[model samples]
Target: MPVKIRLQRHGKKGKPFYWIVAADVRAKRDGRYLEKLGVYNPNTNPATIELNLDGAVDWLQNGAQPTDTARAILSYKGAMYKNHLIGGIRKGALTQEQADEKFNAWVAQKEGQVQGKVQSLAEAQAAAEAKAFEAEKAVNEARIAANAPVVEDAVEDAGETPASEEE
Candidate 1:
């Protein structure tokens, strides 16, 4: 049986969550799988992916063909890159320790980038909230100012009417 690495649909409609799996090509999309590798959630900002790096690389090396989207996901999570490094190791261009060190450095860099994006998104949301508050404050001040003169005029009229009656 030819094996393929593919995504299995899971979550509710319009909010797709997927399971990355290694399965026989003839198996149903969400049906029997050789191994459950990980998950992908696209609803969240930056799209969330939890993958087993080693498992995915093992499948790739064993000739599991990935679908287009699955390939992108695997590439993003570094399985494809790790497989390449392992290939280099096989050809004597890189040692196992060196390949592992390179993979670790890449993972650390990817994590830093993701964290940076999250931080920027949070800062932008805070700025928008602050701008909205300031606009509301300005509107309230204008309303109070517009009403103040009417209140003063009403008080003066009341004072004049009573004094004129007494006179």
Candidate 2:
């Protein structure tokens, strides 16, 4: 049977999520699968992928064809790179240790990049919130000042006050 790697659509119609799976080529998009490889969540600022690296590489080595979207998601998550490294190891151009080292380095760099993006986004949000708070405070202070009550001095009756003697 021809095996294919593809995404099975789930979640709401407008907000979709998917399961990455290994299934018969003829199976329905959301039908039964041989094995689930991962999940993809596209709703995030940066798309999120949770994949089983070893299983993916194994399937690739076994000649399971990946659909276009699945291929892109795998590439984004470095599964393709890992497969290439495995191929290099098989070809004797590189040692397994070397391949592992490269993969680890790449993972570390990717993690750093992702973390940096998240930090920057958080910082921007915080700055915006602070600015809004300050603007609101200023407006409130202005409103209070504008609506301040006026105080007037009371006048005494002319008959009640003692008159000064004329020289």
Candidate 3:
């Protein structure tokens, strides 16, 4: 039986979340699946993907073709790269230790990149909030300044003697 790795849509109307599954090629888009491999949440800023790397690679090795979007998700999560390394090891082009080291290094690098993006986003949000606060402060200060002279003039016109004059 021809098998396929695909995404099954599951979230609400506007926000879409997906389940990565291995299913028969003839199965409906969101129907029966042999196994659910992971989840893909695109609602987040970085498009969070939680995948079972081993399961995905196992399906790939067993000749399960991935849909285009599923392929991209697998690639993003390093399943494809891990599979490639496994292929190299099988062909005697690299040792298992070397392949593992490379994969680990790649995962570490990818994690660093994701962290950097998250940090930058937080910094940008803080800067925007600070700018807004400063603008609001300036507006309030201007309003108080504008009202100051008018208040003083009214006090004088109402024949209100200064405390020093009353003394």
RMSD of each: 1.7, 5.1, 2.7
What local distance difference test score does each model get? Answer: 0.95, 0.90, 0.96
Q: Give me candidate 3's TM-score against the actual structure.
A: 0.91
Better of 1 and 2 by TM-score: 1
> Which residue runs of candidate 2 sit more than 4 Å off their true CA positions?
149-167
TM-scores for the candidates: 0.90, 0.83, 0.91
Error of 3 at 164 (Å): 16
Clashing pairs in 2: none
With a 3 Å backbone cut-off (N, CA, C), the pairs that clash in candidate 1 are none
Tens digits of per-residue lDDT, candidate 3, 16-105, equal 999999999999998999999999999998889999999999999999999999999999999999999999999999999999999999
| True-vs-predicted CA distance for residue 42, candidate 1, Å | 0.5
lDDT of 2 by residue, 1-167 (tens): 99999999999989999999999999999998999999999998777899998898899999999999999988878899999999999999999999999999999998999999999989999999999999999999988776653211112334334343332
Which regions of candidate 1 fall more than 4 Å away from where they truly are? none
